[model samples]
Target: MDPLQAAVLQQFFEYPFEIDQTYQQGLAGILANNPSNTVLLNTRVFYFNRLTGSSITVADVLAYKEQSASASESVPPSNSAANDSKEQPNVLTFAQLQELIESGRLDEIPNNKTISGELNSAPPSQSAVSVRRKPWETSNDSSNIMES
Candidate 1:
C-alpha cells in the first residue's frame, strides 16, 4: 500500500474517510513515525482481540478477520459492510514518516474543559507565573506590580 502524504494525513484526522480499494489504508503510519497501539475509530479505539501490541501488520489484520468469523458459530459470511468505520493505524517507518510529517499531532489531541477547574493559588515553588492578586482580591499589590 502506498503511504498517504502529510497533507492527506491532516485531512484524515479531521474527517472520517474510506480508503479507496485501489489505494491503501494506513492513516496511522502516515502521521506517527510508527503505528501506535490505538487505532481511533470515530474518536474511539478498536483493540484487536487476538493481536495486542505496539503495531499491527497485514498478517494481524487477517488473524483479526479469522477470529471474528470464528466467534460467530453457524453464521454465514458477512455480505454487507460493517456499520462501524474501520480505520487502521498506518504503519510507516520512522524515516519515511519523519520525512512526510513536517508538523506534529499536538493539535489533534482532544482537550476537555472542566466545569469547575482549579484557580491559580500561590504555593511555594519556582514561580514565574506570579499573580499579585486573586480574581476577587481588591487591587493594591496588582496595581503596584503592573505599574512596575
Candidate 2:
C-alpha cells in the first residue's frame, strides 16, 4: 500500500467518529509530506458513506480514482495550464457532499422518502379508553328501581 494510503488508514482507525476530519488530515499530511506529487494530490478520491458515517475502503478510493482519471484523460488537451486546471476534478468539501447526499442528488443511497410514505399511508392509531361506573349510580330500569 502507498504511504499516504497507510497514513489515511491509521488516521481513520484512530478517529473512527470523525470521518471528514480524518480525511482532511490525511490529505493535508500527504500534501505536506510530498508537495511535488500533483498527480497524487489531484487524483485522490474520498469515498464517504453517509449512512455509516465512515469512510469506505481503500479499494473504493482506488476505483473512484481510476474512474476520475479515465474521465479526465478522455477530454482534449489545451495549451493553457488554466484549461488543464479546469479539467481537474474538484474535490468536494464535506459540507457539499453531505448536502448532496441529503438532497437526494445521489440516488444510489436510500433516503427517508420510503419511510415517510409508509407513515403517511398507514392508518391512524386508535387510543384505548377505560370506563368506570360509580357504585351509587344505577341503570334506568323501572322493575329494579325502589320507590322513593
Candidate 3:
C-alpha cells in the first residue's frame, strides 16, 4: 500500500464527517492522493456509501478515473493545455450579472454569449377563454350541502 493511501485512510477514519462536501469530493480526494493504490477497496466502498447514500464498488470508481485518464492522454499535452484555456467559457453568478446589468456595463464583457433564450414566447394570454373551476370552487351554495 502507498503511504499517501495510508494517510488518506487514516484521515477518513479519524473524522469522516468533518468535510462539508459531497461523497464525490471525498472519493476525489482519496483517488487524487493515490490514483494507483487499490488496497483499500472495502474502505472505499464503505466511505462512499456512507457519504453518498449509494453503493459503489472500487472497480467502478477506478474504472471511471482510468477512462478519464486514458481519454485525456490521447490529446497531446500542448493541444490539451490550449484547448483547456480555449474551451473554458466565462462563468458568472446571477448576482454578478445583475450588478453588471444595473451598472449598464454589459457591453464591457467581451465574448459574451447568450446561454439561453425565451423558449415558446409566453403562451398567448387566453383571457378570451373562461377557466373551468372545481365544483366546490363555484359560488353554488347547494353544492356545499352533502348528499346521502
Candidate 4:
C-alpha cells in the first residue's frame, strides 16, 4: 500500500508512533511551539505556525447546530396542556365583558365608557374634542423672503 495510507492506518488503529514516545515526542515537541489563536489557521500557513495546544475542528459547529435543533424540538410550545384554556376572544358582549371583570378574566380600562358611550371602541369623549391644526395657507401666496 501507499506509505501515507500505511502511516495513517498504523497511527489510528494501533495508536503507534508513540503519541507520547521518544521519536514521536521530539516530533510532537517540534509541533507544539506555540499556543496562539490564529485566524490564519483557516489556511495552510497554520500548520507552519505550529500550535502548542489543542484546536477545535469544524465538526464542533455541526454538532452544536444539531444539539440546538434537538433541544428546541424536544420542548414544542403547542404541546402544553394550558394552551387549551387560553382561548382568545374575537368579540365580547356587554354582559359578558361585565362578567369577565367579575370572574377575573378581563381587566377594565380606566375611565373607559360603559355607563354612557360605546364599549367596542374608545369613548365618545374622544370624538367630541375638536382637534385643531395649523391655519390653511392658499396656494397663491406671496414669495418667501430668504434671509442669509
Identify the candidate with maximal TM-score.
3
On lDDT, the candidate that comes out on top is: 3
Q: How close is candidate 1 to the true structure, as a TM-score?
A: 0.22
Rank all candidate structures by their TM-score, best first, as comma-separated numbers: 3, 1, 2, 4
Error of 4 at 2 (Å): 9.8
lDDT of 2: 0.49
- Residue pairs clashing in model 4 are 34-52
TM-scores for every predicted model:
0.22, 0.22, 0.27, 0.15
- Candidate 2 lands at a TM-score of 0.22
Model 3: residue 66 alpha-carbon error in angstroms: 9.9
lDDT of 4 by residue, 74-107 (tens): 7554543243223211234457558877887544
For all candidates, what are the clash counts?
Answer: 2, 0, 0, 1
lDDT string, candidate 2, 1-148, tens digits: 4666555544443443323555545554454445433543342334234323445565645554455456678643343345435433345545766898889787533222434444476789886876676777677774376654
The sequence of per-residue lDDT tens digits that candidate 1 reaches over residues 40-89 is: 33122122212222233444444554655687665555442233323443
Residue lDDT tens for model 3, 35-142: 432433444557656754655456555555455557678755577456434422344455766888899897755435667765776677668778898765746566
Clashes in model 3: which pairs? none
